[model samples]
Target: MTTAARAPLQLPWRTGLAYGALAAPLAFVSLPLYVNLPHHYASVAGAPLAALGGVLLATRALDALIDPALGRLADRLFRQGKGQGHAWWAAVLGCVLLALGFAALWHPPKDSATAMLVWLAGALLLTTLAYSAVCILHQAWGTRWGGAPAWRARVTAWREGATLIGVLLASALPLWLGFDATSALLVLGLMLGLWSLHRLKLPVAQLADPVAPSPDRPQRSPWANASFRWLMLVFMLNGVASAIPATLLPFFVADRLQAPQWQPLFLLGYFGAAALGLPLWVRAVGRRGLAPSWRAGMGLSVLAFAATPWLGAGDGAVFAVICVASGLALGADLALPAALLTGVIHQGGAGGQSEGRYLGWWTCATKLNLALAAGLVLPLLSWAGYRSGSTDAAALQALAWLYAGLPCVLKLGAALALWCAERHHPTWRHTT
Candidate 1:
């Protein structure tokens, strides 16, 4: 059951599509949770912004911390029953909780502020926990598929491409169909994804050596691996580079560009470009290998963001070009890193045994990057005299620098680190 034996030279389109289908719903749920939920509570539910933020912060922090545990749970489930039966059941249960919790979150009780706040906390906790569990499980399932570098890139590309489509739908649908209808769509999507998963036959887990850790034996921790740590370092740096712009996008659109009317178009173009570029990046992986392709993406991102400081009120068109270019680079970010992580797991001797653990930490790092972006950037922006609608020249300049310039610097750092990792680190040096 070695990786090469399991991974064929070519993966069927049907198999890739079926394995990736679940990601759409999972991603569909994520957009509303982060972007729309707070707005709904504040404007629609009349919840205090401060109190709402507190509840969200607490619940999300708890959710991120528990991902590793959930990853371990996924590992245990994979070990249960025949093949992935127990894991599949767990995912089904997670989907049920996710749908219910998501529905409840949007339809909060119209009671006292305290009661509504309490309900929000409870619902959010349930939804986020379920989301994390299902997400980690799905990732573990894919990692256990155990493919060559190109096949692994294709696997991640399909999943991430579906995710971009889901994000696009979630972004637009709520505006057109409203929350109730959108929630219904989410439920339906979840059901479809779950059914696909039930029908799909994933590759079985395998170990490089015969005497690796058994099902009952204590598994090695992902943190204990030097390669995992190095990969995470690169991941976190790049993640923060990406997260800063995401956290500041609306403000940048409203104030920097002074064209809030075009915000949707910007988002659409960005994600659309990413989705469209997935194939090209997969092809790039086939040509240049994973680490090199990822560094190239980081380089592309930096070049795209370099023009941001010069963009002003009437520069929306120019900014849109930047979005499209950076979004193309995003294809590599989404597809290659996780593929590299899969290779890391196998190379580190934890392939099938600890895929869940590794992905759990990976998910944790992603969440923490988002959290860190918001936690540090907003306060720093305010301290520098930038506000939501401020037109002050200095303030706007600060916003531009924080939103665009900072990420470029960070991306360069990440790109450098990636190069160093590939050149120096034994675990990362091999072709993925």
Candidate 2:
């Protein structure tokens, strides 16, 4: 009981943010993995841009494919407790694999297209699997510790706030210092992540509900729990809304904004704002309640995204403000979903063993969001006469629509889905 309970208090507020510090390195790595890897292959590895893009498409699909099994593995490891099953060890393995993958991809030797493909594919697979496992466990660990609305919000806020700081650090370090600094930060970040993982509070299952039988390892019985299925549906719809803008932001900035200089500025503001605003949102979550707080986030996201299509050249000021506003909205986005998911976990009677299974599904939704975002945006942008670097007014307008309008529409869809979830179900709520 003591050991399970000790998992949550691994660090103080500032130090727990160290756990969030892991986000910086992960995001920094994601820079190359999703956002910049293709570019590197094209320019440095001499892979033709077309071939490189295809390779990325194939490899990323593979990476996303293997995530659910890994998620389930995490569930089992966590189920048996950290020492017995080596849950922290498993997470550390993934973290180290992530860093090594970056190192391998960054400093490749055999500069052939085939070599690059093999190397990139191998690395991406390991990293994605590891990331999915670590994140799912991290989320489950948080959710396992049931609490009041404010405390739950605080738990998520600590994680998201660290992620924001990491984003800022990753953004600034590489730009100002260089890749070597990036490498150093990643090493330090992983150490912190491991340390924090050791300290993170796991739910004292015995204390939580002695009368309520503990959940054991999850099986392939997801829909067997109907409420979990419905919540997942809502999550999937909303996740796609968030993913659309993420996939197209770089394209929008480079081509439409025609102001590459402001790219980092915009991202920094948005992510930085998310880190800063987390505490405030936690307060709102406490006062307004989880359902209402989540509703507020969805509403803000829809409103802020809607304003995106109206900006233009020299609209940096407006865009900057939008970035800040949307990021504040992001604060809620980060905290509430996981909190709600935890509620779902408790309610679905999955409390005994399905943490990993539920989180695995959650990870699947996350990857699907990214895939759908890219699958929808990239092809749509191309079809709309928006090429990679075209500045034609019509093309730029299409870019704006892809970046802003489409996401807004999707966000509204997500909002509607959540409304349905709120009205229809509370099976996940268990007052044990």
Candidate 3:
């Protein structure tokens, strides 16, 4: 094992907060890109749903495909001489590009359909690429701060908790402050996050290694690890389940529920609940261990989502309850899997050496899930005769089923996969 992997982590709450600060802004940017952008273009910008789906699929798929290479770049930046300095500069560049791309994405030229589509495609590519670079670096950094499973869960909790805050802000701000102000806030949040990271005391000896790869000790690829593959299967299935709801949330709220005004409230309730429930999940991790806690969360999500198809207009209150329930489950989704993956990396003897690569593929699955949700779901909805503001019973039913029912099935599958892994693979038990 590497010295860095063996080093004990002494993460105080203050340092954990500092280390996780950047996640807030990065996630702040993510909510709109993933959740709101599709609705915006389809409804507000008058873009054709099928074409927009095509664009999102192409750009996001391209974005996901390149993550492994970017992960390799991150490894080089961390392994080379003056590694910390190089990584810092890379993050700075990513932030700057992120800010610019975000602005462009939200304020696209609506001169013509062709122009808008072109602008949206370009902007999405730039924003997602920049987001991936910064996010992979941040995740890799956290993974490098090696610790016991419980400690890793705490680190992930801090980061994911801040992420929920960012999600809450993103959910509320466009409604309260408008998109222009929201964009400005994102830039400011990015700046503040970067500043906090600047003040953070990194594990310099761990991250700033100047060693060149020895010919005899070739690095292992993340794909070569069986545990990573199994874990990613569950992660990707679970992510697709989550992504479907996110993709369809606005439409469900606006059309099916006939409660557009309540969108912000629903969003706040969801993410607020997630943020508040993080501590509970962290404790669960400590007590029950990562996989069990994650399975429990999946079960909770399935139970919450099962009631959605029965809901209709004026059932916003009941839906809010569902949101809170599902959001609590979201806390587990956010914290535990990543923690488990950190354990997987260390156990596989990758540790500080290949954290970026593992997390890169991790992030890649995440994007592909979103991409698949948007690319397939939107076009499929359109094909099924469901428009954004439709009140047709069949159409609304389709939307509800896709939004609610599919996720439950997928979540259950993920839970089952996790359970089988636990039963079959003893290494999975030790990863915690």
Better of 1 and 2 by lDDT: 1
**Candidate 3, which ten residues in sequence have the lowest lDDT sum?**
204-213
TM-score of 2: 0.85
Tell me the deviation in Å of residue 337 in model 3: 0.7
In candidate 2, how many Å is residue 18 off?
6.8
- Cα lDDT tens digits, model 1, 67-106, are 8889888888887778888998999999999989988888
The models' CA-based lDDT, in order, is 0.81, 0.67, 0.85
TM-score of each: 0.90, 0.85, 0.94
RMSD of 2: 4.2
Better of 1 and 3 by TM-score: 3
Q: Residue 237 of model 1: what lDDT?
A: 95
What's the distance in Å from true for residue 338, model 2? 0.5
Which sections of candidate 1 miss by over 4 Å?
1-6, 37-57, 107-120, 204-218, 426-432
Q: After TM-score superposition, what is the CA distance of residue 405 in candidate 2 from its true location, in Å?
A: 0.8
Estimate, for each residue in 315-380, the C-alpha lDDT of model 3 and write its tens digit: 999999999999888999999999888877766667667778888898899999999999988998
